[model samples]
Target: MTDKKTALVISAHAADFVWRAGGAIALHQELGYDVTVACLSFGERGESAKLWKQDGMTIERVKEARREEAQAAADALGVRDIRFLDLGDYPLRLDREAQDRVVDIIREVQPKWMMSHSKWDPYNTDHMNTTQFALECRMIAQAWGHNPGQKVLGAPQMYLFEPHQTEQMGWKPDTFLDITPVWEKKKAAIHCMQGQEHLWEFYTNVARNRANHFRRNSGGMAGGRKAEYAEGFESIFPQTVDELA
Candidate 1:
């Protein structure tokens, strides 16, 4: 699909985008796509265990802390436009108001493609809910009756980024992106998530393993390209191609 070279990422929590889709965001930004990240919540309740552990830390303080971390990560990934929905997490209040706000953003950006969490995640309902919410908003953005006059969105492929436990989440990646060129940028973004420092090394290893998959899928060891880092994505829609190579 073609548009004004724009993309959007719907993240359930503040750091979800950085952990799962950071490489894609950095690589696409270098390729000249204006990628915007919409964080549905600060993850203050569930994801910010470290920050919450601090003495005398209130929910508001935890939210602010995670917001700063998210902003820093966004900056590291060269994302100039990052929006925080500030919806309460642990159970996101995805009411009609939230859906309308997201629908507006989808129409405004008119992204060529979108990124979100896996379709199913029993471990974190927030992640899975965000994906459904994204699908709903995407559908609404394309409807002529939803909001009269706005440019309807095209059928952009929605990509689900890798989850923490892929096996349990039913996340099967069909696409592997060689993110070696922007791996440093992604690393920096990952590091910016101080609230989740324990995941830094884990995701770094995930990238390396995916890079190996990239080579294996591209070609055998005999003819594969040597990629040091990569990211995986599961496409939710069938790709429309003129020819199958």
Candidate 2:
């Protein structure tokens, strides 16, 4: 077994990781954590409006384009591994096989932590469905009886990354990560998602706004350190610590 710590991120679509967790991925890499991103689908049908508008665009071609874009983004973020399950999207669904595949990855990575979508997303049903699937897979991964010889998963904290529209999605962030050091890397990763060019600035603004929240939460308005970029997350389970930091 490797000595390096690992992290896993299960994304509903190819570009979702870039938009939501690119900073975290890059920062974790700098901290010597091997971060792996698993994209359930290429988001060809639902998230690729620009490519769809082009002439002679087939589903396979769209998937290919999205794969390239996702790879570029993952490279920019310094991800250790990025894979597409290609299970299909627009209404991303997972069967027993897909769940098993996720469990395999969980056992393989043995991640110290995991990240996924919010529990509920009104704007995109696929996002919530993907989170549910991840949760279920995590559960399955922890069962020793399912696969006799396979390594069982530990109780890793699963963080729910901020959704596109937090207010409507009912996502309340309990953790704020300062990504000021890795903002440029995150921006580069975001730019790689050419299919969703409109989101580049939108997520940048989201990070900047989250920075303000981080400052307020970390200290106070008067004594808070000025953070330039940040990411917000909601933990699905309570964190256990030996001592209060």
Candidate 3:
């Protein structure tokens, strides 16, 4: 477990943090990282059908419920803060102003690492746009002239978390984090999304499959251990020491 690092995950929708990178988020928190989640929207229009199906569930009510759910998940993982940009859900469009706002958050947080949805997720337009926006913010934060009221922090290590359907989405797992110890925590966090309970088993299976892939490749004694879970990440840049130095 790496100690006392800061991690930020920017997601296109509130539930995305749970569905995609919950394991990684839990592991970071368990390792004493000051984790934060920035959700672009509550996913009211797209992902909240279950919530809205309840009698008299207004859009505002759905959003409020989702916000509470997200916060609970973050708290369960020991996250320090959660921010929601409240942009419109579904077909997310990253306009100039939205990009600037994201960039400002990056500069303010100065995270050691940033995680977001993969840009190539074909099933979700919002996911792709969020990825593009996050990448743009990363570049802007590190650029020479753009100032967002804070010292220009160097670019944080950027990682793309696996999309919901990895193989279909062309999400190859280039890096895997052994999140075995925090698997339960991850599950608990995901359980906070009451609206998504039906999909829990499928996602759990996905994590197990990723763990097996890492075990086969890494070839360590711990690799043979069963009941392990993993999270996959694709680095936006080479993880060379010079890059960080």
Residue range 19-63, candidate 2, lDDT tens digits: 999999999999999999999999989999999999999999999
| Candidate 1 regions with alpha-carbon error over 4 angstroms | 1-3
In Å, residue 199's CA in model 3 sits off its true spot by 1.6
- Give the lowest summed-lDDT range of ten residues in model 2: 217-226
Residue lDDT tens for model 3, 56-83 = 8898998899999998988877787899
lDDT of 2 at 75: 91
Rank by TM-score, descending?
1, 2, 3
Clashes of each: 0, 0, 0
**Judged by lDDT against the true structure, how good is candidate 3?**
0.83
Please give the lDDT score at residue 109 for candidate 1. 90
Q: After superposition, how far is residue 80 of candidate 3 from its true place, in Å?
A: 1.6
Model 1: per-residue lDDT, tens digit, 1-245? 45469999999999999989999999999999999999999999999999888899999999999999999999999999999999999899899999999999999898999999999999999999999999999999999998788888889899999999998988899999999999999999999999999999999999999999999988957898889999999999999889997
Of 2 and 3, the candidate ranking higher by lDDT: 2
TM-score for each candidate, following the candidate numbering: 0.98, 0.98, 0.91
The window of 10 residues in a row where model 1 has the poorest summed lDDT is: 1-10
